[model samples]
Target: MSLKQESPDESLKSQIYTFCRQIANSRPIISVCLCDGSMRAFFGGTKALLEFLLIIKGFKPRLMNYVRFFDDRPAIFYAVDRWVFEKDVDVGFLGEAFAVHLIFPYTPLVNAGYLRAKEVKLKKRLILELLENLVLTFPELSREIRIKPEYFVYESMLNRARLFPPMYNTLSHFFQNEVCEQNFNRVMEGYLIALKELEKEGLVECENGFYKISKSFIENFKSRKTLFTNLFRSAQKALFMSLLGAFPKVLGVLSERADILLKFQFFEKG
Candidate 1:
């Protein structure tokens, strides 16, 4: 469709409806990921996101920028426009504690935006530590799976970056099937869709394949860092700047701490 302004609330709902028509058309078992929490896990891979990530990976000519964040609870609503979620493969590592939010283009939730919700909980910090340690200490996950931790940390540092893959595709990698590109499309598609809407609203613009975070998300984020405003929001503003400041230091500290693991692995492998 054409672009339009997107409100955070609307973006949230449209993302949920994505899977209704696309995923429901698939096998009934695939639809089960809708049980809750399942949708959240799947968000890790989508092409809309890869557009920029392709940059972190050294892909050039990309202009749009996006941010990736995972809170304690994460959910993803899959939309295919054609393919429906059909099955849930057996999986371990993450255990039965997880699920997916599957849908088909026909699912009413596509129009309504909540076919299902997946219950997924992950401490984002813990994940950063885990991936940092793994890349630092061990051999890469596999030759096919790039082990240069820096390139792929934005979305998944571990788990389906494959400490845990989707329950459906968890074991597929062992046999050599690849979903990296397809999954990338699925995850990014939602944002791309949202971007389209946001552009129509004139909140932001895109050139080539990249998108600009509507000034709204950025302006709101910047308010916390504003040193001088009405002077009334100092406390509020400080909180955001403090957080912005901490983000870099925290990442640097972890990288330095984890670099020790990298050094040891490097010499040993050499």
Candidate 2:
């Protein structure tokens, strides 16, 4: 029997998937390594690794410096402790290591360069706001609001760039942020998870295969004097910087509004 050659992204995904499955099976795995040039980091614990993989799956990291898997062993720990504390606790056989090396095509739409913990949370909050506004503004059909998950993800990343160009640009690290057909399923699934989160927050309701804004959410939104209160609270600096940078005219307008500065606590000493 022979195995077929897999692309760099696929190879990386397979290795991580195997490592995750091993962890699930109670293997003695310590961590998964993500390497880029001279920089590298370990993603430990099941939940964190899974989330990391989710980002990789959607982004399709183009130039993988290579992924290395390491398993736990008493000998490695003993050597480390002896070097640091001048004492040893245990010594056993060495652990196993697996490495996958590959280089992907140039000009990949998404890559590991954009994958950051802070950016992930930022993107999530922005997407939630986008969906909320969509449901609220889009005309209802037959007196029932319905939003397709697939369409939302598609438009949010590409078609709707004009509506939130700064946000989409910031969410994407590269110059190109278009969604490829291959990665759309995972991306859509990721957004579906976001939709579920909105539903859990009582902001949206799901019924008959679509989503609509919850009545309470509508009432609250109507009562509010500003629409971005929650959005600003969740992402204060990033959103402000992006918006201000995109539109310098906004700065001139904002500078004249002393009340706005005080309201946002920009005048308060930190």
CA lDDT of each prediction against the hidden true structure: 0.28, 0.34
Candidate 2 structure, TM-score to reference: 0.36
Candidate 1, superposed: residue stretches over 4 Å from native: 1-31, 34-113, 116-177, 201-203, 225-270
Top candidate, metric TM-score: 2
C-alpha TM-scores of all predictions: 0.26, 0.36
Tens digits of per-residue lDDT for model 1, 1-270: 211222324453454334232233332212222221122223333221110001011112111111222221222222221111111112111121221122111122222232222111122222222333333344233111232222222333233323222322322321233444444343334434444555676544565554333445344434454334323332432343243323322332333244332332211111
Q: For model 1, what is the error of residue 24's alpha carbon versus the real structure, in angstroms, after optimal superposition?
A: 20
Residues 49-73, candidate 2: write the lDDT tens digits. 1112211221122111111222310
Per-candidate total of colliding backbone pairs: 54, 0
